[model samples]
Target: MSLDLGRTASPGSTPRAPGRLGVPVTAAEALRYLTDLGLWIDARRSQLSAIDQAALNAPDQGDREALTHDLTVSMALWKAIADRYELLKVAFDSGRVGPTQAEQISTLIWGRLDVTPGQAGEAARSRVPSTADGALAVSLPEACRLSDAMTSSLRARLALEPTAMDVGLRVKSIREGIERIRDQIGLIPPGASRDKANHDLVGLEQRLFGVTERAKRGADVGGYLGPLEVDVAGRERDLIVAAARRVSGERDAATARAKVADLAARGDAIRSLQAQCLRDVTPAPKLGVPDVRALGAVPTDADAVDAFLRRLELVSRALDQAHETYARALAEREELRGLLGALDAQAATSPAITEDERADLAPLHTQLVATLASTPVPLVRARALMAAYQSYLQAVTTNVRGPR
Candidate 1:
């Protein structure tokens, strides 16, 4: 297990508070700052719990007693800070605090708080003692500083000369890391890279063996063990990264190949559509359907494969645009055919047209039909002719109706 002592005080010393706590300009500001302090206190309480548990499990009697004493003092200091903080928080939360209330809150934050029973007033008058039994008066920040000092000291002692269990756990972890790295090394291809990585792993393994032996002999192997663990972990990371890159490169190459095949199919379909549009529709767009084969085979190198994929994407987009243009042109031609048919049918059944007028319009309609039905129909000319025919028919209808 790992302990994260967040924002710890500097090693071997209690943090000193400022000459005086600065009063917050507003109650809300005070509340915000206090809220943050409350979170820090909560974190410290958790750390103290872990430390207490570790102390209870301490193998040596002397170490256990010393840790117990430290834990007691730290807990007491924490309680002092926590108690004062809760009170100040309630005052601030009441929403009635002004400049005077702000000053009082500042005092509680920075001034020594008396935690001694039955001596609160006397403790305020006399110079406060730091002993565990006497009038223990410590400000919120001061209590934190003192608690941090003790926590740091205990943590340092444990780290410098960890118990047999700690040593065993550490050794087991390092061994596991070495094994993982060795497995990762097998993934590297047979080349200078693999050989060099294998050589580095051998050296780390030797160092780990030596450290394990020192730990067996009950020596302080922390110095050797810590660095060896770091080295092994770093090598593991490097090998994992290399393996990831190789896998990624393989996957990218496969994707690039798949994209190429798909684009080829699309290009073929687009070409067929283009042919049809050119044969049947006048003024068809002449955009070229890109030949994906021109991009060549996907390269083995990662960067080259990436560039290849980018080009494939461009080709795919161009194919899409070309396909859309041709299909739209063909659709428009069909639409014009439908419109012409509908108009001719309307004119034939229209009561406004006399038999003599129908005879006169019949040849014009036939000529329009022939032009529209011809291969490579001219869209511009078709539109103009349709418009003129519709206008002439409308004019005859209007004349028949006579001033509607």
Candidate 2:
């Protein structure tokens, strides 16, 4: 929405009076279209997911090729929808604006169609999400808002230029360094080896730097990968790296809490064993020992209740200490729950896993589900938490993409 002061139209360009959307070609209208696309893509994804689940869960006797083909077609449609958004997202990021809303629309449309032949070929291979029932939907009602936005962008006639990739590469390289730093933070006697991690990190950074440099120079760039690379390195002073750190911290916290809980349970079992040992070692109370309550029956006024008071003080203190430990254990469990939320929030900022990448995480996600299902929490809440976390990351990543 920030107006570019440098926009200039060539000679003989017709200046436009504001159109129906209040700007030239309605960018707001364009955005609305994108929103619509998101809705359909999401719905399609959900439908696809259900199909995958059903197929995988059933006896292994389905038409695999046929199913794959059907899903492939669905993926194509989804790519078309996503491409529409990616184009707008790029232009907006590059600060390209036209003199009127119509021009803005024209630029966006042209940009989509203007890909280098090689880029187009690569795009053709990018799969779409497979689905049709619309179980997963993109938020659509708000998509119609592009009309004004396109118009406003056109009014500015902002300049369009290819991004300089060196900066991005340099920034990405630093992230590798930061990752090593993060590993160092935990690599102590009680932790992992930071030096070994750092050694591996150097190689990792070098590879990342080399690849990024190539991408900057127009090598190995293709489809959604280009935009995704931009997202990792193009944002503010590499806040993306900061985000990754948050994710790591969340993961560590969650793991630590889990470990603590396991240790505490073990300690409780051992403590119980120790208590039994003490009982056995006491040799059943000797006949000379006070008969706890029977001492009250003594006829000589020997302050019976006083004898009981001293023993009660010791028992009460011991119970109080145990209660404190139990309370701490409970609090730690709650903290772990909160850490899951934090981790989810951080993961949400991660670039979305494509259908292909989703396959990789499928195992981990499935494991998470099975583990969560066995917990006291309801399946609904566990499932909801993961979905919500995914949605949150998608939104945050989208925002980082910026509007032209």
Candidate 3:
């Protein structure tokens, strides 16, 4: 059920002038202009009909009466123009009117049109004598112009344009905007900035109240309402930006606090490992572990939080280096102990070693065992002694085998 309204004019045809108070110089132009004018009249009639219905349904008594009176006058004026246009169109379409007659008909468009008795009587009573029979001396174009002006005013008054919101809807929207701004204002910390924002909001609320009052009285408050809406919108935007910054700052602070706790726990674990390493391994790397508690609690300010996070990163790196140093020292100590024990077992079990070699190896093995068993063992000395013990056992084996 779709309908194409068709194009306004034929392709390649120049647009006709709007309802001007001047006649076309040629008959063809005049006929074309008349056809376009008739189409315009039809469209205007439909628009007026819709407006008439809206006026009848208006809730306000004063608005309905005022709108209905204006619509009546406008429709009457439109009828006079349409009737004249119809007469000229028929005459021209008959194919009998010559250039001279067409010129005469063109005068009807640029000349006065007929008026209703009410208009004629008013004109007559006013002593203007502008009407002959029932026709007024106002040109058709002038009549159309008057009707157009009235129609525009009516549309604006009724909020009939597509982009024009109803008064109640606009008021509600502004109120909602105010509430949103209020909520954002609450997010602002108590400071000079928040106070200033509150001041601006108060002003906007006052302006809104004035606009609402005018609207209730049926006054055209559009001029007042528009600027208030812009101010409210602009203020809301500023408050929203401020609120977002505050939330971001709080989030960063929370994250920094969590990081502080994590780094503190890690520092304690690294210290414990360092103590163990000191007890078991001599000549350990003397790296100092940083005390994360010295950095203190995370700050509330955004800039301070950033600085605190950087400090945490440095502390974390320090802990990593210290942990690696201490853990590696412990690992080396355990590795040497395992190696020394394995070599001693091999020598005691080997059949290549005679009883005399066993007596030779026993004292050196006892000294190596005492060195490993000592707390905070001297790693460098332990390694040297283990190497000597292995060499002595290997020599004893070679002697037992003779020339292998």
User: Which tens-of-lDDT digit does each residue in 1-404 have in candidate 1?
Assistant: 11232444322222233236664435665655565666667767877777888888889997887667656766766788778867776667565777777777778777656654333333222222322234454456645644554554455445533455477777786677677678778888899989999899899989988988887898998778656655665466456445544655676789889889999999999999999999997987899999999988889765576678778889989999999999999998888789888888888777888777777777778777887899998888877877777787877777745553
Task: Give the alpha carbon lDDT tens digit for every residue of 1-404 in model 3.
Answer: 11123525331111243344444335556556666776677767877887898899899997787677667766777788778877776656544557665666667666546565364234222321122233334456545644554565565566565656687876776787788678778878898988998999899899999998888899998777666655665466445434434544576678878878888899999999999998788887899999888988878765576677788889989999999999999998888889987897888688898788788788888988999899888999888888888898888767645464
Q: How accurate is candidate 2 locally (lDDT)?
A: 0.38
- Clash pairs detected, candidate 1: none
Assess each prediction's global lDDT (C-alpha) against the native.
0.69, 0.38, 0.69
Give lDDT tens digits, candidate 2, residues 259-332: 44544454455456444333332221121111123223312111232333444444445544554554444343
- Of 1 and 3, the candidate ahead on TM-score is 1
Candidate 1 ranges with C-alpha deviation above 4 Å: 1-168, 189-193, 209-221, 241-255, 299-310, 355-367, 394-400
Each prediction's RMSD to truth: 22.3, 32.8, 29.4
The TM-score values for the models, in the order shown, are 0.52, 0.21, 0.46
